[model samples]
Target: MSDTLRIVLIVASVLCLLFMLRKISQSKVRIDDAIFWIVGAFVLVIISIFPQIPSWCCDLLGIQTPVNFLFLFMIFILLVKLFYMTIRVSQLESKVKELSQRYALDHMDDEVKQDEK
Candidate 1:
């Protein structure tokens, strides 16, 4: 790779790692999401420094080309992140719905008790 390209890649990778670390440390991030981001950042840094490893991995996996391996790895990690986010969103939605339902039920009960009095 050209020196400029390599430098750009390195900078971008580091930035991504920093972002992941920040997210992981934040209270807004769930444990599972933080873990996923951390693992993704780890993989990115690993693959970026050891380009040959991707080729070797491709060979072991019976993939046709080194670039294919890189692409596959990236795509796989992205999909994992997507799935994690989907699950997290689902959980949050469920919690919100449950809380709303509970609030409504309690309020209705309170109104009924007042009406009885």
Candidate 2:
């Protein structure tokens, strides 16, 4: 319930959401994957915002009672995953663009040949 814990959770949730949105906007995710990630993000936000949830989890896991550590750990993980996802999306986009350009060039050559005939 400290200010730092609250801030950490908020920042992590925001970063995860923004990352996901960016990928989706870039056409990285299909409809089903988008839905799944959206739901997962929502769940993460809910868990981060509710301190009691972490407290309960700690109790169940027989871990320490400090939710701050949990928040920090979760944020770190989310950031790493975001970075990985962004890199993958960028690579896929590049591949798609490259393939599309190659196909268009081939089609254009075929059209030119037909015209010459």
Candidate 3:
């Protein structure tokens, strides 16, 4: 990769890391989610600084080019993250449904008791 591109990537990664930290400080992002983003940003910065690392990795994995390897790696990471988020959302939805049902039942019982009185 060109030096200019590497510098840009490094700057962007640093900015993202800073943004994530700010969000965490403001309680806008959960620690668990922030951890993944923070780590991703760090990895990007490291990769940008040491472009040879990706080339080495590609060679080790028998990949043709560093860029292709990076694309594949990023896609894999995103897919894993998406899967985790899907599971979390599903669990949250189930909990919300259960809570709403319980609340409705309690409300109905209260109304029935008032009517009886």
**Steric overlap count per candidate:** 0, 0, 0
Q: Candidates' lDDT values, in order? A: 0.75, 0.76, 0.91
Taking all chains together, each candidate's TM-score versus the true structure is 0.73, 0.47, 0.91
List candidate 3 stretches off by more than 4 Å: none
- Residue-level lDDT of model 1, residues 15-111, one tens digit each, is 8768877876776667765665566666666666777787789879999876677678778878887897799899999999999999999999999
TM-score of 2: 0.47
Stretches of candidate 2 off by over 4 Å are 66-117
User: Is 1 or 3 the stronger prediction by lDDT?
Assistant: 3
Roughly what TM-score does model 3 have, to 2 decimal places?
A: 0.91
**lDDT ranking, high to low:** 3, 2, 1
Supply the global lDDT for candidate 3. Answer: 0.91
lDDT of 3 by residue, 1-117 (tens): 678878888899899989998998999999988989889989988998899999999999999988888898899999999999999999999999999999999999999999999
- The 10-residue segment with the lowest total lDDT in model 3: 1-10
